[model samples]
Target: MGHLFSNYYEAVSVILFGIGFTTLLLNRNMIKKIMGFNIMDTAIYLFLAAKGYIFNRKVPIVTGEVPTPEQYINPIPAGLVLTGIVVSVSVTAVMLSLTIRLYRRYHTLDIDEITRLVKEEK
Candidate 1:
């Protein structure tokens, strides 16, 4: 649809989210799964940024005249995106560290294999 094309960022974000979700679901490699999750996070950030942007609008700071609400783009989405980035990075670091430990213990990164080995140990 024309509207879909006009809002290309949202469309692209949706497509990226689908790809990430599919990768997360279909891949068995731990690193690939993490990559997929990062992709999804990126898509969400892009979507939020796109939604926060407005044509012909200034940033929220007022320089000379008192600004009306309509004069500036909303700042909340940008703030949310920033917060999400911080959380995403923290989560990624934790995941990678855990994955490293798993690799060390199992000598493999395949989750199914690790599960099987754990069951065998039990």
Candidate 2:
């Protein structure tokens, strides 16, 4: 549709989210799952950034004379995006560390294998 084309960023983000969600569901490898999660996070960031942007608006900064609210884009989405990036990085770091520990102990990255090994150990 014409509206879909006009908002290409949202469309791309939706497509990326679907790919990431599929990957997350289908992949058994822990690393691949983490990568898929990161992809989903990136898609969210892109969607937020795109939605926050205006065609001909400036950043919400006071440079000279005071301007009306219409002259600048909303800052909340940008702030949310930045916060999301920090949280994503923290989560990724934790996930990677856990994966490394699992690989070291079980000598495998397949989640099903790990679950089986844990069950066998019990």
Q: Residue 63's C-alpha lDDT in candidate 2?
A: 88
The 0-to-1 C-alpha lDDT of every candidate, in the order given, reads 0.93, 0.95
Off by over 4 Å in 2: none
Clash count per candidate: 0, 0
Question: What TM-scores do the predictions have?
Answer: 0.89, 0.91
| Candidate 1 steric clashes | 0
Across residues 64-112, which tens digit of lDDT does each residue of candidate 1 receive?
8978999999899999999999999999899899999999999998988
**What residue pairs clash in candidate 1, if any at all?**
none
Q: Compose the digit string of candidate 2's lDDT tens values, residues 13-104.
A: 99999888888888999999999999999999999999999989999888889789999998899999999999999999999999999999
RMSD of each: 1.6, 1.4
Candidate 1 lDDT: 0.93
